[model samples]
Target: SDVIEFPSSIGKVTFTHKAHQELLKDCQKCHASPAGGTIAGFDKDWAHKTCKGCHVEMKKGPVSCKECHKK
Candidate 1:
C-alpha cells in the first residue's frame, strides 16, 4: 500500500510506505522477509523506536507527535 494508517487515541499515524521504500530501497529494513509480510512484533513502542528512531537518526522524517499523529 502507498499509505498505511494506524489509528490511535491521539490520532491516526499516516505512514508513507512508498516514500520509505524509495529511500531505503530495501524492504527488509522494515519487513521481516524480502517477500514483504507482517512484522512479527509490530506495535506502538516498536514503531516509536524503529520508525521514529530512524527519522531521528536520519533527520529526514516526522519526529513530533503532531507531525505523525494527525487528527
Candidate 2:
C-alpha cells in the first residue's frame, strides 16, 4: 500500500476505498464520467457538494464546517 499527500486551499483530505464506498448510494449518483456542469471538482468539494449539500438542504445534519470556511 502507498500513502500520498493531496494539498488544497484548506488542507489535505485523505481518500480511501472504504471511506468512499460507504458514502455512495449508487455509482451513477455522483461518479458518472464527463460529469454534468454542476458536478463538483476535487474529492473534498465533491464530498461537500454531495453529502453536505443534502444535509444542509434538508436541514437534517450538522452544518458542515468546511461548507463555510476555507480552512
lDDT per residue, candidate 2, 34-70, as tens digits?
3323344646667678756766776764355654333
Instruction: Give the Å error, residue 45, model 2.
Output: 5.5
Candidate 2: stretches off by over 4 Å: 1-6, 33-47, 55-63, 66-71
Best of the candidates, lDDT: 1
For candidate 1, write residues 5-49 as lDDT tens digits. Answer: 999999999988888899899998888888897898999999999
Q: Which 10-residue span in candidate 1 carries the lowest summed lDDT?
A: 28-37
What value of lDDT does candidate 2 attain over all alpha carbons?
0.52
lDDT score at residue 67, model 2, on the 0-100 scale: 42
- Which residue pairs collide, candidate 2? none
Task: Give TM per candidate.
Answer: 0.93, 0.38
